[model samples]
Target: MAAREYGQYCGLTQALELVGERWALLIVRDLLVGPRRYGELAAGLPRIPTNILAARLKELQAAGIIRRAPRSRIVIYELTPYGHELEPVVLALGAWGFKAMGDPRDEQIITPDSMTMALRTAFRPEVAVTLPATAYGARFGPAELVVRVDGSTLDVTRGDGPVDVAFAAGPDIRRIISGELAPDRAIATGVVEVLRGRGELLDRFASTFHLAA
Candidate 1:
């Protein structure tokens, strides 16, 4: 075999060289949701060593996959527009992985911000119903989200108010919507509990927000 030139490969190989590590993808995944401070990133991915994460961030920045912005005096990491294009690819891979691995019994957990973002992006407006009469709160991780389906829009938040339905689950929204956990089973197992609203309302909301075949 002839000698290989490290820099002569195509751009894809070059890109992989920077982000093909085990934790690098997860780093990108976190950034896909939104910009995060170093401490937030570290907490989100508890398995990654701090030094390695710092190194990967540096490398990704060098590769033009991410950029650092000052949230104050502190720097927060955010994906470039180029990096945002990878969202669909990452989501598809996650869907495939979920199907292949089968659903786990363990309770999944996600942040309120992440849940709201997921709903906003994945929601199909055509499937939505105008339910001005109902309001609800969903809890994920430390954040409590209040979802109000009024007229044609869906409003979600992390505060308290009058809500018709509340989804208090520990699992990530991605896993829950992908059918990794049966919503009823999650409630039955005590992994999630609803503070208000009838079962029909939850079913209607789920029908509208869940990923379709």
Candidate 2:
């Protein structure tokens, strides 16, 4: 059970009581990337206090949203089947919140899990199916990802790979994702830097992965 409860009998109330505490859903978000050790989760969410992380883990385990499994003499946290069902919900929530994300605060930092979910949220498979298969090696500050789109499928992973375009950007990449800035303009204004590969492929990237703000 969660540390705090709403004392109501509604479904939404029940759901909130289960995972509504601060940093709870964020823990879920990181676990969606894959199983992670306790330290890994802490590292991904650097700002979360250690005690809060421990309590949230216990609460989630009690609700069957997550489970601990022993691996190589260590314990790791992974989402349960019921927890995996939150994928669509989290993605939708992320998309909704993205509309209000104008800029990153000075202290805010991007993590691999968050970036992976962002790519998944912005991917337009219907539009991608009509274009040539492409890949992008993207570096947003210290976070890096290889975004691959084939037909209507998309795969994003941490690290660089053979890609049509390899570009770097800061949080302003949201401008391109929101279609608020054209790719050429983004490049011209120094909002994005082409590290390697043809710069024109950025146009393809902008088309394949976008979310209307």
Candidate 3:
């Protein structure tokens, strides 16, 4: 429950009361990726204060959005079945916000979970289904991911692997994804670097994962 009530009878109001506190939705975002131990959550959300993390966890559990469970002999937090329903809402929010994300600030950094959600948000399933399967090792700043696309399914995981193409880029890669810059031009401008394998595959990657700016 929220610390304070809006004293209104509305679904949105009730939803806000449940998870409108600062950092609450972000906590839900990380949990949407997978169950995370306390330390793992804290590491992913580097800016969250320890006391605040604890408080949010308690509030979420009390609201039945998340639950505590023992995993591998340690306690981890995971979203409940009802909480899993927020995935579409989060993805829509990500796509909506992408339009306003022009450039990242110096202090802004990407995390694996965030990158995962971003890719999921922008993935074009119909286009992907018409293309050949491909795997890419993508490095966005410090976040590394092995992205695989088979038909309409997209899977993103951490670490490197045998990929058709490997590329590194910073936030500027958004231009390529948004089709604002051609993959060839992005490479020429140093906005994207083809680290290994066939660089042409990057065009395929751009088509597979895209969101108009």
TM-scores, in order shown? 0.71, 0.97, 0.97
Question: For candidate 2, which ten residues in a row score worst on lDDT?
Answer: 1-10
lDDT by residue (tens digit), candidate 2, 1-213:
766778889999998998899999999999998999999999999999999999999999999999999999999999999999999989999999999998889888888889988988999999999999998999998999999999999998889889988999988999999999999999999999999999999999999889988
Model 3 residue pairs with clashes: none
Cα-based RMSD of candidate 1: 4.9
Better of 1 and 2 by lDDT: 2
lDDT, candidate 3, 1-213, per-residue tens: 788899999999998998899989899999998899999999999999999999999999999999999877899999999999989988998889999998788998889888888899999999999999999999998899999999999998899999999999988888988899999999999999999999999999889889998
**TM match of model 3 to true structure:** 0.97
Looking at model 1, how many pairs of residues clash? 6
Which residue pairs clash in candidate 1? 108-170, 108-171, 109-170, 109-171, 135-163, 135-164
Task: Report, for all candidates in order, the number of backbone clashes.
Answer: 6, 0, 0
TM-score of 1: 0.71
**Whole-model lDDT values for every prediction:** 0.68, 0.93, 0.92
| Candidate 3 backbone clash number | 0
